[model samples]
Target: MKMVLFLTVSFIIIGFVVVVSMKGKMERKLAFIQENADNHKNATTPIILWIVGTTFWGLVSMALIIGMFFMN
Candidate 1:
């Protein structure tokens, strides 16, 4: 039970960090693209990264919730 709690908290913290980092990264990329007219093609990478990061976070959260339910 303690291990499960530790893992859940760790993953949540990691997910939060990933989200904040990705948001900053995406903003920087977008700003760069805005400053340069020809860099529009690179915009998809940041968007994809943001989507993947959020999706992974959501999945982990759901999995943890389910695991906790079953543990009881």
Candidate 2:
């Protein structure tokens, strides 16, 4: 039950971060699109930020799980 709760909270935090980041990215993209209506170029998402964020979260979560397992 403790592990379950930990996983649930970890996922919830990660999910919230993903949602908030995506929302901010989308908003910026929309603003760029609106500003450059003539170009019609595709607004690109920041792949690097997403990659780094995911990697950081994955590492942290794995470390937490491993630590918990060892403690138990």
Candidate 3:
């Protein structure tokens, strides 16, 4: 149970950080692209991928925590 709790917390924290950092980077990239006249097509794929990955981790973490609670 302890191990599960630790892993859940770790994953949630890491996922949150990744999501936040990627969002910031995406915002900056969009701003830069707006300022310049460069093609911004397909530029959001990486950000979308990161968000999806982070969301998966977050969901797994939540499920683990919930499972642990039910087990206890």
Among the numbered candidates, top TM-score falls to 1
Models sorted by lDDT, best on top: 1, 3, 2
RMSD of each: 2.1, 5.8, 2.4
Compared with the true structure, the alpha-carbon lDDT of candidate 3 equals 0.76
lDDT of 3 by residue, 1-72 (tens): 788788778878877787787788878876776777467766767767776787787788778778887978
Number of the candidate with higher lDDT, 1 or 2: 1
Cα TM-score of candidate 1 = 0.74
lDDT of 2 by residue, 8-70 (tens): 577858776886768777677778778897785544445446657767777777776676667
The lDDT leader among the candidates is 1
Q: Please give the distance, in angstroms, between residue 30's alpha carbon in candidate 2 and its true position after superposition.
A: 0.7
TM-score per candidate, chains pooled:
0.74, 0.45, 0.69
List of clashing residue pairs for candidate 1: none
TM-score of 3: 0.69
Q: Write candidate 1's Cα lDDT for 1-67 as tens digits.
A: 9899899989988888878877887878777877885858866676787888799888989899789
As a TM-score, model 2 comes out at 0.45
